[model samples]
Target: MFRLNVTTLCAIKWDCVIVDEAHRLKNEKSQLYKACYQIKTRRRYGLTGTIMQNKYIELFNVFDWAAPGCLGPREHFLEYYGEPLKQGQRISAPERFVRIAEERKQHLVKVLGRHLLRRTKQETIGHLMRGKADNVVFCKMSDLQIQAYRRLLRSPDFQLLISKDLPCTCGSHLTRVECCHRTAPDGVIWSYLHRENPDGCECCPLCIVLPCLIKLQQVSNHLELIKPSSKDDPEKQKKDEQFASAALGEDAVLVGGLQQDESFMGMSDAQHCGKMRALEKLLETWLSKADKVLLFSCSVKMLDILDRFLVRKAYSFCRLDGSTPMGVRQTLVDSFNNSPSKQVFLISTRAGGLGLNLVSANRVVIFDPNWNPAQDLQAQDRSFRYGQRRHVTVYRLLAAGSIEELVYSRQIYKQQLFNIGVNGTSEKRYFEGVQDSKLYKGELFGISNLFRDLLETVFTSEIIENHEERLTGIHRTSSEQCAKQGLLGEHAVSSKLEIEDDIENSELSALSQEQDGIEDEIESPNDTQSCSESQYEHILKDAGVLYAHRNEEVVNLGGAVQKHKRPKTKEQICSMNDPKTLIPSFVVDEHQRLATPSTLKILSENGQEDDTVGQKRKYEEIFKLEEMDETTKWFLSGSSLCPTQSIDCCKAVFK
Candidate 1:
């Protein structure tokens, strides 16, 4: 563990070397494995529960590490035992497969059993009941998420990655949207390290493809991790801004007491994520019984999101991630096990999966799936390992048909592959897909397994900030509405404040403009002369929606449905527009028929969504967005009628 220099390491090893968790030494190419291979020892022991995680090649490497030439060279091992074992896993005919596997089993045990010993609890004891329960709960992706996923596949920019029509610019606009309904602010570099490799040369495809693919992966799990990056055209942006700004104004309601507003408890970002929703349901059930739960995710971003959620839900939780210092991991683990109040332990899969004792918790939710089945098992074993008294139930939440499903499938293959080498059993199910099929190449992309490379570059951190601002109400309260309420007109609201609020909405115009075929053509107010009754009904309905549940039957008295006392501060205004009452962005976009080309393409491809994908939003997409003058939002005329230059009233000194 000291200086990694070979001379320093070779000098000390004279008698014997024991490698704990010896499966790690399965890779002969790794520097650590190579270093351990160098230490001179007459007698050595390598201890591991799983040696050949994926291929028999690793088994050969480990045998070589412990004893030179024990299994011969890697090539020799592959020819004699590895190829036969692998072929046995792929054999389709059951009778023939099992017969060959039986023959190979005898040969493998005889050859390796001399230096290796593996025994299950049942093998050692006559009969032993298992203490671990594994449950896989399939989750469905939101329609918006599924649409974004399809868009990533077909977007001309993405489909033509290196083409002249679509240069691999820093901004992977079309692809990142697949990861979340939101993504980090634009212009922010996702990674400086990805700009170059260890050799300092520009990374091939990695610089472009990896990040966008990761963004999509994030979308598959939870949108809260990455802010949505899709931008609307300027015109669409202005209209949506007007809607969000005027709809809520400064009357947004902020619920200070989390418990006081039980209705809003479910309104948090947790529901937007399928895994989070499932997790909350699981936690509520377990925590109700006072049982502890360990929740693990590979994404620290997701962990942070969960942390915020648990705190909001008022559940006691402890978290450990890559950012968490190694020195404090044990302390946190102890705190969880020792404290009766800590019911949830949020853990990072890579760090928390290695070797941890978490027997105090009996319920586990693997927040996301992992490609490596062994790592997930290690993470789960934290509770079900040894000291666990209660029967541990581990729930692996996977998006039903999404990439998470594929990853879990791959994990099973790796696991079955491992079993073949150790137990010589071809227990693989027929529909599990081929092991080592490698790339999930799409004919549409003109590429082989690009998605695999994308998935391989494990995501580290995703930008996360509370996007509560964008979730503000869509009822845009205009200057006229302000005047009707005897409130300060839109003029009183500072232009800078208005601009900041519309920062995200600004991009809405760009996206909306791009989808010209879809954008609703606004008709002039004069075009609606004949349909007076219908227009009146529309106005009345709009007014009714504007104020919410107030009585619309006004009698020119102190009461009016849309009437409200003006808010004092922006925060209170936003808080007043209870997020609970706010429309889901997807619903609004749908109602307005503001779907982009990508969304339309996905919809057409899918044709009709099944009931399982859930019902389409009932609120019709807006047929038309009233065109407002460009200067109407930012400035006001100097006329007395106008609420400009802080003028309280217009006495009209004319004539």
Candidate 2:
């Protein structure tokens, strides 16, 4: 119901929490069980038919939620009820488990009986359906799928098993390449090592080499068509033959070459597509009417099928899978809640079962059930939480009478175990005493085959039975039908009207612009050219150029001028080198300028003529100088004996 939706459920703050098929919460260590236990509620109720299918510790999860201290610590509980065994054998605690189950059940009732409520479908809702949901089982695989699988199995390299340290039955120390079954040559091994050597010696050749080889072979086979053929031309024939020989030299090389060319592009394996399409169609029909839906399956592959359908329908949906990034989960939930256009939310139980609030949907559908009832319930609770206002309808789609049924039956029986506990019995005795026939009868049977069979039934019931009346409503030809209905004429008239409107608008704009002289201005070349030139110059300046020109101008003044005469010769210029002529008269009279007025007056008052006095003084000084030795006289002489002057003077006078 809408009131039971997850949002409302969480909002109402119920005093008790009831989880149907409670065995799913058996693992106390599981995230979902832990989440349930953490819920702040006064009472917790779990309804299941089978509780502990695999191990006694599975009950710890339920007990931990219903009564935290009743089960004791995991270590203490295991020590009391768990069994230990040597390697290569399974360990169980059947004898000690039965006793514990009985004691725990009583304790559970005493503590939580007032709030706990549970009933089987047979006791409550049995009359709703005839017997049980029918299931069909089919083992169908296309040739391509089989071939692919066989190729994988035949590969000597088990890359995944080797690289992941996965369990392997093959007992060989030799590398995949060194194995006798391996076709790669020693040289090829070296090449692979050189190109893509393992990080460490710990690598298993099966994991690395085998997968690579298989992928390469697949690629090569796919690309074979594109490979140049010898038969295409005589010139290429020789090359092709040589290449063929080289390729055939070793099995590994051949395989590698084939794989390298294999083309997965634009190619779909028909079987996978067909199966996927079938699933999609089924989903499309169901979703057409269903406001909210939940699809569950043990394998993520089934979810992929639904994903393709959602994509084809252009339906906005969110996917929760093992590989989904953790950060995006809450964002996706918020988007789904806020957006009504979003239709489907694909969730993987392992990743999304616990701690997720998906109360928007009122309907929950299980694509398939696994061995754990708790997992199925958790998936259903995604939509069946508090806020669900409508009556929640849960659809458990099963393949009747298949291994799926076996898993389902086991889940139910296990839930019952939790409901009824063992009392002081050995673990082995507890399991040995279980009624296998009763347990197996409850499993979901033939679900896969049932769907396959239902395809025909659906088509007949939904389409073929009413085909005649539907066909009579329309003409045979699609075009004729449209025309007869007047749809074609309406479409044509609409298109013509749109074109006419566009043309009229264009004419009106031209006329208005012409009247305003806008059109004439637009058509004028001078205005356009001037605008363009200005724009061009502006662009150039913006591009960091101070000046930009398209042409160069030259101005010439042509005239001849007369040559000037040479300057006077250096001899002529030096002829006037006389000291008296060279020295200014003021410089010669510099001493006279420095004399005092009294000194000049004394010379005048003494009646000494200026020239005679100067001559007498000069002669006396010369006589005094001559009285000394010749060397001293020469040193004191005012004039030199050698009186040679410039040749220029001699030349000028002689000439």
Candidate 3:
């Protein structure tokens, strides 16, 4: 048996050792290969389908691990084969270069073949099935989302970054924004530009960019994630400490826009994300067939959005993210795998990728693409490994015409690089050439012509000019969104809810007034001291079950009983709601027959001159439609018209 940790493996003597993905030790300079070289083994088998990513020396290193010094010394091998093969790549004569490269390649392959047992998928098991099928889905950005995206691109921070001519950073930002429709908090951006905390942001430009990117990812999932402006206050420290002391729950997480009543549980959440809409439809179809789904995103912030969404949707789910304490993480994983009630496992790629066996879920949805494709691949393998019996299908969601497309393309390039190194694979036509110098350039995330047009649209349209609050979707919380939007005249949902609470309190106060009026109506217990005691019991009963003591003496105020108002039912709501704001008008059907144009009142004769003038044109339009159709059509076209003359003379001639 072989171990991945080099030190442990070296310490244990083994009769036989097998290393998978042996190319990991292709670098002789790596600690893994050096430590592994010291391991005592009677027979070592190095298994890999990919070897020699950059040079032939990689193949030499792998062989050295499997059977030490079989390919001669590292330096000698490089001088004999690696240098010539690397130089031959730049050689001018194609045939000559091919001959020189092939010779070196054959020698390296011969050395590797002695210790390596290699087989292609076709050669190993003819027509054998693969467990995973990759799918890419493109989501359309909503009109409002598009407007917010353009406005963000035009922000001072983005423009300055462009002016500094940093393409790679721009590219990085683009990749980030493609997933979630956000980049930085507005306060952070404002602070960086002004060197002032107008929005209470104290972060630097660099700090702002990362959070902005995180928020953007959150926005792509749900607009409400955009965090509002906030500042730490020392005055509230005592109150906060006291609140913390009264531990009601393990966490004090307040996810906004989520009502405890499950009222907003349906489709309203999907409006902010096209992907969410797509996912809802997908879930409805797949879940009906009893297919369990494993949904994953790299950001826990995104997983939180999904968690809230799944709960609102009433989907039985289990979650495993970084914050899920180690003890509970596996329990959640096992529960999801075995529990029939749980249909979804909402997972963050980072937390769930390494060692969890999630063979229970047959379907996986990768909500966002990763820069390093292996992270996603590992996440997919979580469900496909060991206990899985079903053919696992993977869906990767991305925005159309977005940086995700570029990232997807880059993933292919990375996979090819791995294939070349581990399997000695070659391509006929390399589509995306790796450029070493481009890592620093902003052109990597270069604003395209389409992006520029969107920017121009933002400047020219009223969408950006007038409702600036649309960008609140770029924030992290509904409170921030509501505060900004409320000030900007958009619906302040929380403020309305607060007003409603005040109105309810006022109604309770009115009930207390009714209680006082009843006391005045009766004086039986009114021996001053006795009446005062009765009044105390009367108030106690009115306080409701929550505050009323069970031992308190009760008085039956039968005549003055207040009827408890029942919550409005759907039908009751419909009945109480008056549909009309204006008086309803009855259609006048003269003798139940359609009225002819001639029967209609000629309004030009009305006494109101201005009204008559407007009506005159309508009358002209009506009568002008009749008789001499060709002549009428010609006259209306303004052909051969007497420009100076009133048309009465020509009309008379026609008559």
Provide backbone clash counts, one per model.
46, 88, 32
RMSD of each: 30.4, 51.5, 30.7
Tell me the TM-score of each prediction against the true structure. 0.55, 0.34, 0.47
All candidates' lDDT scores? Answer: 0.49, 0.39, 0.47
Candidate number with the higher TM-score (2 or 3): 3
Candidate 2 residue lDDT tens string, 1-655: 4323445445556687778767778776666665565566777777765455555576555666677766678776555433221000111224354335434444544443333344443335433322211111111222333233334323323222223332223666754334432222232232344345433233434334533433322221222322234346754444333333333333324323422222332122222322333334434544565465555555564565456556656777788888888898899888877777777788887778776777666445566565666677667667655554433445454322223334444454454343333321111111112332232211122212111122112221122113222222221243344346554344333432332344345346544632432211111132211123344333322322211110000000000011112213544333323222221222212212212111122122112223322322232232232233333322222232221232223334433
Over 4 Å off, model 3: 1-131, 166-221, 225-268, 325-330, 426-433, 438-655
lDDT for model 1, please. 0.49
- Candidate maximizing lDDT: 1
Error of 2 at 191 (Å): 21
Query: What shift in Å separates residue 63 of candidate 1 from its native position after superposition?
Result: 1.6
- 10 residues in a row with least lDDT, candidate 2: 551-560
The runs of at least 3 residues in candidate 1 whose Cα sits more than 4 Å from the true structure, single-residue gaps closed, are 2-5, 91-102, 119-130, 156-209, 228-268, 431-655
Query: Which scores higher on lDDT, 2 or 3?
Result: 3
lDDT (Cα, tens digit) per residue for candidate 1, span 1-655: 4325777868775788888889888787888887887787789899887777766777788888887888777787777676555555442335465456546755775667678766553234312223454555554555445554554444432343323223235555544233221211211222233223323223323344655556556767764433421254554444333322222233213212111122334335564455666566656656877888999999876776677788888999898888889899999999999999999999999988877888899778887877667777788878876566555667677765456655665565566556556654324222313434433222112222334222221111000011112112221333234346644333333421342244345346424532321111121233221223334224323221111100000000110111122323444322322221123332222222221111112111112222211111111111011121323312212232323221222212110
